[model samples]
Target: MRLALTFLRINVMNELQYRANFFLQVLESVVALATGLIVLSLIFAQTDALDGWTRPQLLAVLGVFTMVGGVIKFAIEPNMARIMSDIREGTFDYVLTKPVDSQLFVSVRQFRLWQLTDVIVGAAVVVWAVVTSDGSEQGSVTGGGVALGFFVSLFAGSLMIYCVWLILTTGAFWFVRMEMLEELFTGLYRAGQYPVGIYPGWLRAALTFLIPIGFAVTVPSEALTGRLTWSRLALAVGFVVLLMAVTRTVWSWGVRNYSGASA
Candidate 1:
């Protein structure tokens, strides 16, 4: 833990060199939020509700989505990409020689401290649009519930996304160009902006199983909005375990495969 924090501190010190980039990051986050909110407004303008989610409820969900997506895209995803690149280019040899667990080393390698603004802004949105009002009677979540469920959802979503990335990038043995798939993952995360229930049956199933993205954003949002059920909670937990196992297996296999490829 101390070593990780030390590395994180080093990353921060390195990032301090480019303070201008942090301003650009803040600007980019606001622009993205405005675009998302505008689109949501336009959609709600056409319909009273989307998938049983009212305006405030939808706002809360978007808040959750933005926060999770920010963390994943800004730090988690980029670090995973760095891992895959290192693996393919022999830089990972440095990691292999280290005494630390390679996966842990790669997983938490980078810390883009500035991108945390998205989290703050997203939380603010949830606070303003959902938690501030007393709508307990309206079947929405209590503020306490939203806060608890938000962290739970964020944890589950981030773990699941990291595991998925591990599984995806671990395939770099034969497919050295798998970095392109991050583009697809980015698009899928964007799709999480809306309620997954609005998707078609097949699409929803794919999001739940094949990609398991809904858990990353929607299910947690559901919990925040008081729409979660035991079944969903169980599934989220189950998938987290399942994904962890699968990603580990794939990463191990990839290591062996890469060894063979190199030979």
Candidate 2:
């Protein structure tokens, strides 16, 4: 924890040197949020709901999507991209020489401070959605229960995403130029802005099982909107554990295959 905090402090201090980036980040976040709202408005204008999800519920989904995207851009994506690049350039040998756990060290080495704007904005949107939504519409779910479930699921979902990303990035050991995977992941992640149920059965299965955006965005939204069931929550938790185990194994195997710059 101390090592991670020190790295975070360093990143914050370094990024603080360029204050203008903060404004640019805020602008980008606003534009993205505005575009999302416009699309949401058009969807609701045609019908009262989409696949049984009300406007506010869908708003919750959007908020979670934005928040998770912020997290990825802020920390996970930057670090993973750096890892892949370092691997490709054979500079990853330096990382292996460090005393700390390589995975933990790599994970904490990069952080985009300004990217947190989306996280704050998304949280505000989630609050607005929760407040505006009718109690009966939410099945009379209690705030405490929803909060507990939402937070737990959100943590689990984010960790699952991190695991999946690392597992994919580990492929850099053999496929050195895996940068294109980032664009592919982002394109797939956009689908999480809406309920997975609205997609075709095969697409839904792909999202739920293959990419995991369904669990990352939709599951947390379900908890917030009172649509999450205990069984589903358990399934998400179990999947996260499995993903973490798989990621660890993949990372270990990849590290073993790394020949380093000296080699």
Candidate 3:
């Protein structure tokens, strides 16, 4: 945690040198949020509910999507790009020689501090949606349990996403030229902006098990909107543990292989 904080502080200072970038980041965040809201409004105009989700519920889902997406852009994507570059350039040896865990070093070495604006905006949207939402359609989630569940699910979802990115980027050890691999994740994540239930069964299954878009966004949204099932929450937690173990094993193998090749 201390090392991560140091990296964050350094990143903040570096970003402070370019003050104008702050406004640019804010503008970009605003544009992205506005675009999402506009599309959502158009969808709701034709139908009162989306896959049985009311506007407020859908908006809550969007907020979770935005917040999680911001976290990816802020840390995972940038660091993953750096790892790819280092692998391609044969400079990853520096990381291998360090005493710290290679995966931890690679994950937090670079940060886009300004991208946190999206997180702020997304959190605000979630609070507003929760406050304004009528409980007519939702189940018995009238108290703070919903909020607690939402946050717990959100944390688990974030960890799952980080694990997924780690697994993907670890492929850089073998496919050094595959810098664009992260783009695949970015494209697939767009599908999570709405509830996964509206999609066909196959697609919904793919989202839940294959790419895990359902766990990342929809599960948390369901928690917030009082629609999350206990079984699904357990499944999400199980995925988190399983993915974390798998990613760690894969990362270790990648590091070992890279070390062998370098030696």
Candidate 4:
């Protein structure tokens, strides 16, 4: 924790040097939020509810999506990108020489502090949606259950994403042209902007079991909207554990096979 904090502090201070980026990020966040709101409005205008989700409920999903995306951009994506670059450039040896675990070091090395704007904005939107909806059509979620379930599910979801991302990034060990991974992941992540229930059965299953955007965005939104069940939450946690194991196995294998640029 201390080492992670040290790295975070350094990253924060370094990003603080470029204050203008903050405003740009804020602008970008607002524009994206506005576009989402417009889409929600259009969808609601067509009908009263979408597949069972009300406007405010969908809003909560959007908020979770935004917040999760912000987290990915702020930490996971940047770090993963760095690892890919290091692997390609032969500089990953420097990371291997360090005393810390390679995965831990690479994971915490880079932080885009400005990307946090989306997190703050998304949280605000979620609070607003919760207040406005008041569990109407969503569920009767209230009291401590909402907070506890939301946070727990959110953490698990984010960690699951990180694990999957690392597993993909680990492909750098064998494949030199891995840049498409980022674009592909980003494209698939957009599916999280809405409730997975609206999709066809097969796509829903793919998102939940194959890709995990369903767990990442939908489960947390379900928690916030009082729709999450204890069993499903348990399923999410179990799935994250499974993904973690897979990620570790893949990373270790990759490292063992990697000959580095010098080799």
lDDT agreement with native, every candidate: 0.79, 0.88, 0.87, 0.90
Query: What is model 2's C-alpha RMSD?
Result: 2.1
lDDT by residue (tens digit), candidate 3, 20-120: 99999999999999999999899999999987899988899989999988888888788888999999998998998999988888888889999899899
lDDT of candidate 4 over 1-263, digit per residue (tens): 78889999999999999999999999999999999999999999999899888888999999999999999999999999999999889899898899988888889999999999999999999999888885743444456878888998899989988998999899888895699999998999999999999999999999987788999999999998889877888899999998998898988888887854336
> Candidate 1 local accuracy as lDDT?
0.79
TM-score of the candidate numbered 2?
Answer: 0.95
Worst 10 residues of 4 by lDDT: 134-143
Cα lDDT for residue 40, model 1?
Answer: 89
TM-score of candidate 4 against the unseen true structure: 0.95
TM-score of each: 0.92, 0.95, 0.95, 0.95
In the range 1-263, model 1's lDDT, one tens digit per residue, is 87778878988898899999899989988998999899989998999888778888889878878888778865787787887788778897787788887777877788888888888888888777665533533334445765666677679878988888778878776777787878888887777888888899999888877676788778777776777665667668888988898888887777777668646
Q: C-alpha displacement of 89 in model 1, angstroms?
A: 2.3
What's the candidate order when arranged by decreasing lDDT?
4, 2, 3, 1
Task: Name the lDDT value of residue 244 in candidate 2.
Answer: 86
Winner of 1 and 4 under TM-score = 4
Off by over 4 Å in 1: 132-146, 261-263
Candidate 3 achieves a global lDDT of 0.87
RMSD of 1: 2.3
Q: How well does candidate 2 score on lDDT at residue 27?
A: 100
